[model samples]
Target chain A: MGRTLAEKVWDAHVVRQGEGEPDLLYIDLHLLHEVTSPQAFDGLRLSGRPVRRTDLTLATEDHNVPTTPGPITDPISLTQVHTLRRNCEEFGIRLYPMGDAEQGIVHVVGPQLGLTQPGMTVVCGDSHTSTHGAFGALAFGIGTSEVEHVLATQTLPLKPFRTMAITVDGELADGVSSKDIVLAVIAKIGTGGGQGYVLEFRGSAIRALSMEGRMTVCNMSIEAGARAGMIAPDETTFAYLEGRDHAPRGEDWDAAVASWRELHTDEDAEFDAEVVIDASELTPFVTWGTNPGQGAPLSHSVPDPATMDDTERQSAERALEYMGLVAGTPLRRIAIDTVFVGSCTNGRIEDLRAAAAVVKGRRVADGVRMLVVPGSARVRLQAEAEGLDTVFTEAGAEWRLPGCSMCLAMNPDKLAPGERSASTSNRNFEGRQGKGGRTHLVSPLVAAATAVRGTLSSPSDLEPLEPLVPAADLAHQEA
Target chain B: MDAFTTHTGTGVPLRRSNVDTDQIIPAEYLKRVTKSGFEDGLFAAWRKDETFILNDPTYAAGSILVAGPDFGTGSSREHAVWALMNYGFRVVVSSRFADIFRGNSGKAGLLTAQCSQDDVELLWKLLENEPGTSVTVDLVSRTITAGDVVAAFDVDEYTRWRLLEGLDDISLTLRHEPDITAYEQLRPAWKPVTG
Candidate 1:
């Protein structure tokens, strides 16, 4: 059998083969955020080592940064943000501070700036670092010590990960998004299903996705307990990277595409494990339980505990109790107090546009608060330029600045105690949105519909909004 | 990071599976910039209930955590390890650990000793039955002991050696700088430099 795409990337990045030890893996990019880097920088300080490759390291303020787009007011959050800038300055690392045109979630900024590329090993202190793998890079989350390790030396000691081919074939139904496909996959695989595996998402449905949709799928690989998720680079990948600020240019662009074109898995490649799902068969999926794996179709009732396996039954029971729901409850009857459409998972321009498409010329339900946060400042600018912000705000939503808001609840944008939300973010773990808060993970379209009806609803549950104005009209509005 | 040759401390039994780093040190507490004082944040939410092992007076002085499998399951924050260490834990005795958590523990000099479930249950029982009795974890011998129960534990030998010698991985990796430079030289110029 031939080598898998992951194996090929791993082979190329090996700097030193540790015969009796873990191989030394060269890191091509190191993305950092406020939450995990402060301590790692301190580790460098005590060790008396200068940053080995400052050029490869890029820092941004995401977690704990307020989404309000003003001077950070919270003392603790302010300190965290400022400390990152201070550390970046002291260590000679590049930083995209809040309010900077380039500032955004590290994952969002990396790709938007054309910094993420094929066949590179990307490491970040945030789990969503797997988002970079959408470009065919081998990227995964790292701990603070590893952050320091990468800082002092642009390499990490690593053991090989097994490969799993998640082949999603067929066409997605109208209105179903990449988020739903991933949720459906999680529901089948369970929370820890992909443990010790690097998932290679293949087949036609994956290939058909835009770069944004692919990033959404790869972003949540950690939710399935996979170290990383990747899709082989193709025309779509090359088109997405071409002409961007940090992307290859001129003859270099031609040479880069030549190398990236060779990144696909061989026809005879043997996967360690394989799972197959038909994209057309999936419905708009959402998680009723605390974990992302505890998901069901929007049309179905919450799962009966008796329906689950023995081990899963216990967790399902606890999840139901925490979510304040009973078995057999109709998932559509689950009311939400808030709706959040942001995060590295679903805060890109495409996600905002998708949600905006749902909320256009509509009004949010009474007693419901909806927040539409852009994944990055640039995304916000793009959304505003295209009148997505107007569509959202006219529908009673708060169009806020870019940051990881209400996703991990590291910032002030959080669900109050006992408040439930329909969220587009990955991970619905208990207290993920806030203390005593309940989260239902859904796609951007579902999130918008939930905000409109104040219940866990999908687009089909509401009167469809008018289709977007013609291109000429949209352009005229832009002027 | 300290070298973990041997540690003898009372074990605290936390009989919970999939205790994630979010629970270990909630995202709320992660705003703190310092790493050394996270003991206050370790299991901040769980400890509020008097029933948790950390809140139990018997394990108040415990320095070893004997918990159920999948301990430290979520997130890549090293604060979980820092909090455990600051709270006096020098070793974690679990059936298994999340990959990142185990890696973080090794680099932080907090030993993670993998024991079988049956063995872990017996240790939990022993600790609950004999309050304040210490458990001895020997990295050199790769064994954990309590009273009459002795069990062989396992960790990656390379990680074990690094922990035993208190190696700073940054320095260890820098030894390969020449190889890294060679690869960089050969890297196609069209491949955009991350900087």
Candidate 2:
């Protein structure tokens, strides 16, 4: 029997495997942020233990840092960020402070710096750490206790995960994107569908996506209850890593690609479970309820709870009440108060350009407020260099600094109570943005179009504004 | 970590599915550096409603949470575990649990008992009908017992052993340091280092 991609990675990283004991897997990279690392560092201090591999561990200030600028104003938020800085300095780990050009969401920083590579094991204290799995890495989220274990020993004793193959075939339509495809998959599988498995997104459509699109898809694996998500490395993956800051150079790069080429699943390998999705069948998808799985096509109407089973009906009832929606309403007509276009999921340069293309000569709707936050400082810089920032700002949107803003709302950027938004970030869980904040997860294109219409929409729904003809030009033409 | 052979407590039947960590403890409470003292943030939003279950006197002292399927589904925040433990919960009974939450619960010495959907439904009914009903989660026998209804539960063997013996993971992994060092030497030079 041949080995699956996940099995091969797991086997290669195993340091110790014994009878009735979980396998101790060595970690290649450990990314940290202020929100979850303080307690782990404190645990290390109390145990009188030194970090085992500071070379493999990295820390950054993202969750609590203000995206708008100035010092971190919230006392508690400041202390968390400061504590991370002190701990990283004391323990000799690389620290990327708030103002550092490299500082951003840990997930984004890892890939942007070329630190994330194929056939590696990445661990972070944040769920979105699965974002790094885009490069064929076996990455997953860890709790603070596991974080401490990795800090002290550089290894985690983890039980084997079951493998799942989520095969998405066929080409997506013109206006749809990776975000829509993933939303459709979650809706088909439910949030708990992928529990206890590491999903391998395979087939034609997945292979057709760019690196950014693949990252967006893999980043939401957790929302579907998967421990991690992976796509086998290919020419596209090699191209993205070619000249990155930390990518191997000269002869080392040639050797690395040779090994990466072997990282795919063998032809005869088997998965514990399998799900197949037709990419061509998907359209602009959006979450209509508190959970990611409660989604519908943009052309469809809000589903009636009466048509669902007992448990689902109950969940729908609660979701409907919290979302302030009525059944039978067209999803495109659902009004939104805000539009957020950034996160580790969709805050890359490509995402910004996609939004910018929609808002180039357009203005935000009268009552809508839009925010375009880049995923990293590098991404922000790239956007500005391409004039994407001018396009967004000229459209009446706020183009701000890089951080995990509004997505989790740990910093000052948050939604007011009862406020609703069309967000490009993952996770539509209750109160995920802020207390009483309703979120409808969408693609960058959908987020931009929604901002211009003040309702849930797609680029196709936007009608070109009547081209302005000056009165003087009209008078001259009349003469 | 305390050993957990068995626990007996009143049940708080949370009838919600997909109860994500955000609802367990919102992001605002996550700003604290310390892990403890999250009881006030457990279901902070739901607690605002005067008619919420935790607000009712019947289940105020409950130390066991009998929730709907797919409990603890989103976010890897261990703060959810701390919040539940701080609020005095020792066991969470559900038909299904997200992988990370189950792992976090095990590390924090909170028992997560998985029963069949029918059994969970029965437990919820019994707890709700008799508001203050005592539920005993026996790790020794892998069973949950409540008022004329007894059902088997499932937990992994290694986790079960660790919970029964109150073992620390870091200490255990340290015993195999030689193996880790040997593995490190054989690692490819092309692998990137943070520094």
Best by lDDT: 2
Q: How well is candidate 1 docked (DockQ)?
A: 0.62
By summed lDDT, which 10 consecutive residues of candidate 2 chain A come out lowest? A60-69
Q: TM-scores for chain B, in order?
A: 0.97, 0.98
Q: Could you tell me every candidate's TM-score relative to the true structure?
A: 0.95, 0.98
Question: Residues A220-335, candidate 1, lDDT per residue (tens digit)?
Answer: 88888788999999999989999899998888888888888889899998999999999989889999987788899999998898987655677788789889999888999999
lDDT of each: 0.88, 0.93
Q: What share of the true interface contacts does each candidate keep?
A: 0.62, 0.86
Interface RMSD, every prediction, one decimal place: 1.6, 0.7
Q: Model 1: runs farther than 4 Å from truth?
A: A306-310, A465-479, B129-133
Evaluate every candidate with DockQ and list the scores.
0.62, 0.88
Distance from true position, residue A379, model 1, in Å?
Answer: 0.6
Q: Any residue pairs clashing in model 2, and if so which?
A: none
Across residues A401-436, which tens digit of lDDT does each residue of candidate 2 receive?
999999987888898889999999998878889888
